[model samples]
Target chain A: MIHQISVFLENRSGQLAEITHLLAENGIDIRAISIAETSDYGLARMIVNDAPKASAVLLEAGVILSMTPVCAVEVPDAPGGLAAFLQLLAEAEVDVEYMYSLFTHRAGRAYMVVRVSDETALTAHDIKLVGMDELGLK
Target chain B: MANYYQPEIETASYEQIRAWQNERLVKQVQHVWDNVPYYRQKMEEKGVTPADIQGVDDLHKLPFLCKDDLREAYPYGLMGKPLADCVRIQSTSGTTGRRVVAFYTQHDIDLWEDCCARAIVAAGGTKEDVVHVSYGYGLFTGGPGLNGGSHKVGCLTLPMSSGNTDRQLQFMTDLGSTILCCTPSYAAYLAETIHERGLKDQIKLKAGIFGAEAWSEDMRHDIEDSLGIKAYDIYGLTETSGPGVAFECEEQTGMHINEDHFIAEIIDPDTGEVLPEGSKGELVFTAITKEAFPLLRYRTRDICVLTRKKCSCGRTHIKMSKPMGRSDDMLIIRGVNVFPSQIETVLLQQGYTANYQIIVDRVNNSDTFEVMVEMNPDMFSDSLAKIADAEKELVGALKSMLGIAAKVKLVAPKSITRSEGKAVRVIDKRKI
Candidate 1:
């Protein structure tokens, strides 16, 4: 399970930069990021290198945010490899709530962090779930 | 039981009420002509005189006094008597523009209080009952008018003077106030606080005389159910005498105008033509009894209908339906009067444009006031923290200016609709 930090941002100018600047100043690197937005406000979700450190600085800066458990998987970097893994989940009728790509260290391979409607159903799939530590980085 | 302060006038016959108005209108016209030069000059310009206003039938012959006229008069030009003769003055919020100060002689005060006393009595008040007046004192007439009336009724008067909800509830519980006097929003607030504090059963209130702002029948029911009291409506303006020019009797159908002191008329707002009875139009009042500031045919700008419907309460005075709306762009939120121009003034003063929209809605039976302002291009690029800080600053400025807290939201530039003609600046979602 990877700790995904979701930050609530008012749909205004430089909101993303504010969050990124605060994280950068604290020396916390964001490994993966995705944004879901509405006309008035938006939510920026990120899987950072250090969850506790990212949470502390974001909270200190008065950024409204929360942390959730997400399953990270290392899929083949090739398009057919990614398609084959999704087909297995589709065959099992496992609903993927949301999935975002991450920067992986190993060549010819990619990281996909996903939040599924039911994580317990993932045990039936043949794909292995990767841990936050497995994504090696300095 | 029927309780009327002055039974003779309150239960007067139709003919007697008409005779009183006719006689008083004639006398008041003569008085205004001789004492108020401003009004006299207006009448002369209209080719009319005191002789022309012989009775209530001739009320139309007189000139109309609107808010602009009050502004034109300013501090004292329209005052009918010598400044020394006036015992006191009460003023409007003046949020719209210039403040309107109404001069009142001691005689005027006595009559105005008597009118309020009539309201108190109609709301089941007595010497045994305690009257808690939470209307703001000083320049606002809501407090002093009801306070004087409470004194006149010989009830144990509590001049609470608005705000400090804890103190209001403390005294209300300890003193056993039977009659509550204030704006309906404050009444609703007090009711909500009492229920939340679980002191509902401890309250001994029997009735409330609420006015000085518009309230709906549904709100009246809400207040009644929450406070466990019969909520009554009172109608008046600082231009007249304040919250007792007319009052709701037990019938609760409409407010009865004190015919002896005032003659009520409905006129087409645009045409200035008098509308017949039961016709909805702008409400106009001719003050027949006020001495220090007698205004003949003063336009109230309140839209309502006048009905001679026989009330079960037995008051012969003509009843006026609750004001449906206003002819101008004035709004009442949380019982505090607000004008769009007041918001515009604050915005422009804060270096924002006049292009803003005021959204007023009733949520959980309380007014929710929000002002959505359009950010300039420069402001639109500011950091989120800076934008939020700007909103907070505006909230403070508006609260200080209007004496009420308002939520401020900064929106994208030109997001709010703009009109070439008279811009629609307010959107009130309250069903009532």
Candidate 2:
């Protein structure tokens, strides 16, 4: 299980840039990041290299944030990679909530952080799971 | 016995109040007619004279005096006394337009102080109490009015005008100040500071006379809880001898108008017809006993109601509910009269901060209303859907409260500019 930090943000200009800049300034690297925004507010979810360190830095800077459990899986870097993995999850009855790409990859494979309720279902299918330690510059 | 500054006047009978108003109203009318040609012309146009305005019932016959009249009568057009007799002058904050210059003779100052003293005593102030006045001094009437009242009540008046919270607390603790007099917002700020500095136990405030602006009952409770005092609301405009024309008693229901000094009447702002008791309308005041700057039937523009109901405090003076909104500042959004206070009441009821801004503009020949509420850290959630749901709930609550739909935008914390003085809560950008 990987720790994903989600921050509450308004649909404002320079806000995403502000968080990214804060992470860069604090020497915390974001491994994977995605934003889901509505007409009024936005939610930025990030799988940083060091989730606890990033959470502390952001919280210390008065940023509204929370951490949740997610699993990062390596998929083959090909056109059929995501579809095959999603089909495997469907066959294994792994209820995938949402998935987004990571900024870094290892050995010709792309990393996808998937929000799922049953991590055992993924493990039951022999999926290769990656933790926060193996994501970025350790 | 209740602690009253003037027992005879505070507990005056309605008949006695009527008798005093009748005598003073007639004389004030004559004074204005003789000394103020600006008002004399108004009377001539209305075909009424001092003789016509024989008593309180005849108050309606006099032509109404509005803020525009005060502006037009700028410096001396409304003076009921000669220049030499006028010893002091207090100007309004003038957030509206032209500043209303209210002249005060020595007698007027004495009476105004007497009004403030009534408020202090009503708030449980005594000669033994050290009154800390935090209302701004100089042209603004809050400081002077409360300061004079504290002196009149023989309280150790600290003449501490607004601002400098650290020093205010320093003096408040060191001198053992027992009564606080400032705007309600300032009182709240002081309460916030006292708790933050961990000096609430050191504070000795028994009562706080908060006025010069509108505040909610919830806010009163908040300040009372933090400061350990009964919060009383004092209502008065600079146009009508400053912040002691009416005051809240121990009942905490409504402020008892000093009916002998100034007569309060509710009137329809549009038609200028006086409304009956309990009918919420624009508050019109007749400064029957004011000598230097007598405003006859001054339309206060403050929307409120009046009640002569027997108060538990035993004051026969008419009690006025807190002014709901100013007719001048009332926003007519999409043909519905929307007051920022209505929005504030809804916000406070919903357990949100009062730090909100109202934006009204015209869009495509129609009105657009929006309320920008600061998204405090507590209300923020990691889920956007939940935050949107909260915004939608606020919109529903505001629509039901204001009888019109208002776009509620939860902006970032401190995105909206905080106010130091009177908070600019409404921005009407309609080009009408």
Candidate 3:
């Protein structure tokens, strides 16, 4: 299990840029970023190099955020890797709320974080689950 | 014991106050009948002569005067004394309808100042304290009214007359201002500025007299907490003299009306029938002692209740509850009387900013009530479900407070345009 930072972004042009700028100013690198938006607001989720440090800095800068627990898994850097992971989840009836790819790959192994109802089924299937420290992220 | 500007009148028995009202109201009726032909015409149209009004009880026999009548009697029609005797004229902001010019003679100004002196005294002000008057000066009554009252109280009066925040701060700190006089919003702004500038220690304000606008009790405590001073609300209209008509005592419950000068009554806004004491209705005043502009049965349009309940402050003058809202500002959404203050109270209790906008419109033959609040960082949430929960909670609380459900929308912080003077709180788009 790894931590992901989700920020509430008002549907304004510079809101996301402001948050990202503050993150860069604090030397916290965003490993991956995805934005899901509605008409009036957006929820921007990020996998950062330093989740804890980034959370503290963003919070101190008055950004509204929540630290969500997600399963980080390393799969073969091939198209069927994601398909195989989805098939495993389907067999276990695991509900995936959302999933996004990590920016960095290690030795041709792509990393993806999945927010799910329960991750015990994936671990039961002996899937490769990675954490921030295991992936050598700060 | 409460400090009083005039003990004889301030603590006068009900009988004494009644006698003064009886004697003065009768003379005032005749004063208007003879001097202000507009009021005389109104009295005659109601088929009531000066001979018909003998005392305060006969007040209802006289016709009620509304703002429309005042607007119709524009420049000088409402003047009871000629320009020769009039020493000063203070006008209303006239944001709602038309600007009303109220004239005051030397004696009128003296009495009005005396009323303000009582307010200052009630707020724990003393001659030794430096009183700062920030209410707008020239045409607006707040500045001049409090200025005169501060003089009567013998406080070192700083006639700041609003604006120039830096100068206000310099004077406040350097002069050691003890009492602040301004609208509630300005007081809040000043408090915010003080904290932002980190000048809290230099601030010497012990008490604040805030008025000329509607504010909630929640806003009162906020100002008090921020400024480290007790905030008192003063209620008045430019029509019935100005900011010192009724003022809050240390009791912190209600404002004691200066019954010796003006007679107050509550009346059903629609039927024009005087409601019994303690009934919430549109406030009506008869300036029995005002020389230049004597208004008879002048409807204040502020909806408030009067209480004869014994006050610990020991002032015998009747106390008027803080007005719920001016009758004109009251919104009837689906037949429920909803005040913006009610929504404000709910918002503050839910840890939101006091600055909010209420938008009302009509659709499909029904009224739609919606409140737009800024999404401050503290109350923001990342989850859509959590954000929806926040909105739902606000809607539920507003429904309970307003007796009608209002849709709550959270926009970006500081999105609504706040005016230079007076933040626009309500927008009614109904063409009705």
Candidate 4:
């Protein structure tokens, strides 16, 4: 259950390159990005490669976005793979309100994408959860 | 059934309007001690003269007059009647600091258009109706005091001055306008452009008066349900002779004050004393029939309450009420007249950081405003399109220092809200 997106900008400067140039001119690929800001607007949040065609090219370029369902796991690209998956969501009490990471060209892998305030800890992490047609690189 | 352009002085008798405000405060304190020597040197330095004002209970022994004594009596030191007995001059939108002006006399524009024809016969108007007005003509006594009170209530007037909300609804639906006179935020911007042009059944309004600014009874029931009429509330002041000096009958509870040509009085705005009648202070006014600006115990930094109750539309003078706040920090927005030190003198003349706030709310029923400001660690490291072109050059230097339009937000660099004593610079949220 991965599908992210989120937007809503206006803390100005080329609004994250105007939403990554309308998702790289509609060939979408971002795979993991975060922003959050505040003091007058900013959200951003990505993990694209076409979350429904970057939410219809950022809603026909007027842009202010949304689309959630997150959890993407996969860790071990070495060093205790995200401290043993955050010590198995702190021994399954599970509550990671936010998390981010990327780096996948295989070789010992890496992903991390969480956003969990407990939605059944998305099936208590049987570990490998990176769906969207298995992120086989665009 | 309440149309009184002057039913024996709008239903007189509180002992016949205190015997016509004790015979016009004894002939306007012998006409400001025989023609204003700066209110006879503030009544000879409050030693009290005009034979110690012999009526309206010696109007608290005269001498108040504020706004820095009309900016130290600028042009013609409060002219009681010279300049060949004045015929006009209105002024004051000097937002705040110079530019009061005033004068009038043609019997002070026939008693300021008979107190704006008793607020268009207490907003039910006649002369087979059609008024219109739209306040803001020349030196601004709200469009020649309701265009000479819709030509002394013989209606059919128009003189549409304010802005052009689509040719003021094309002469308010091709001249069938049955009274509307402006400034309750331009009648909530002509009732939001007649419900956004669906032209509320081709308009034929049946009453509205409003006033230069400050409006709320939930924006008078949202401009009386988007202009289906009955919106009243008129009160005046271009130093006592502008909108109409108090109106609202049909008993929408308060206003009434023409107290036989102005007398009002609440006081104690920091020790000027006199508060008694239902407390809550600072409104003042004396003008007892202004013959070319006759302000006597003036000091109206407005904040109100005056009652005398008893009225289910019977109008026996003294009502006041709707001013409720402002012994100075000005504000009013949408109906123009703002003041946070005129947005901190256009943010310290455009260099910024006097840290800001403003806010003011009420959306669809008009007036929103905003402001916010703060960004100053070298404008918080600039470059967010140069902080949105410095919030569009501080919304064009606060719409040229408060003639209106605001929404300039910039926040984050100390994020607004610092105080140790009195810096809560306006929030408003219009519940009035």
TM-score quality measure for candidate 4? 0.38
User: Model 4 chain B: which ten-residue window has the lowest total lDDT?
Assistant: B377-386
RMSD, one per candidate, in order = 12.4, 15.7, 16.2, 17.3
Best by DockQ: 2
Candidate 2 chain B: 10-residue stretch with minimal lDDT: B330-339
Q: Which model is ahead, 1 or 4, in terms of lDDT?
A: 1
lDDT of 3 by residue, A1-138 (tens): 888898877777899999999999999888988888777678899989898899999888767678877888988898798999888888888888788898774677898888877878889987889977886676
Q: Is the docking of candidate 1 incorrect, acceptable, medium or high quality?
A: incorrect
Residues forming the 10-long window of minimal summed lDDT in candidate 1 chain B: B377-386
Candidate 3, residue B270: the lDDT equals: 87
Candidate DockQ scores, in order = 0.03, 0.30, 0.21, 0.06
- Candidates in order have lDDT scores of 0.86, 0.84, 0.85, 0.78
Model 4 share of native interface contacts = 0.05
Ranking by lDDT: 1, 3, 2, 4
> B1-432, model 4: which lDDT tens digit per residue?
767887888787899889888888898889878888888887788798877667887788777888877887787888888788787788777654656888887888898898888878877787888888878788878888888888887888988888878988998898788778887877877887788778999998977888777777877887888787888888787888788888787768778888888888898899898988888898898888888788888887889889887887887888888887788877777666777877888887778778788889877767798988765534432123445676678798778666677887765434456688545777888776
Residue B420, model 3, lDDT: 93
Who wins the lDDT comparison?
A: 1
lDDT score, candidate 2? 0.84
Writing each residue's lDDT as its tens digit, candidate 1 over B269-302 gives: 9999999999999999999999998987889889
Sort order, DockQ high to low: 2, 3, 4, 1
Inter-residue clash pairs, candidate 2? none
* Error at B207, model 4, angstroms: 5.1
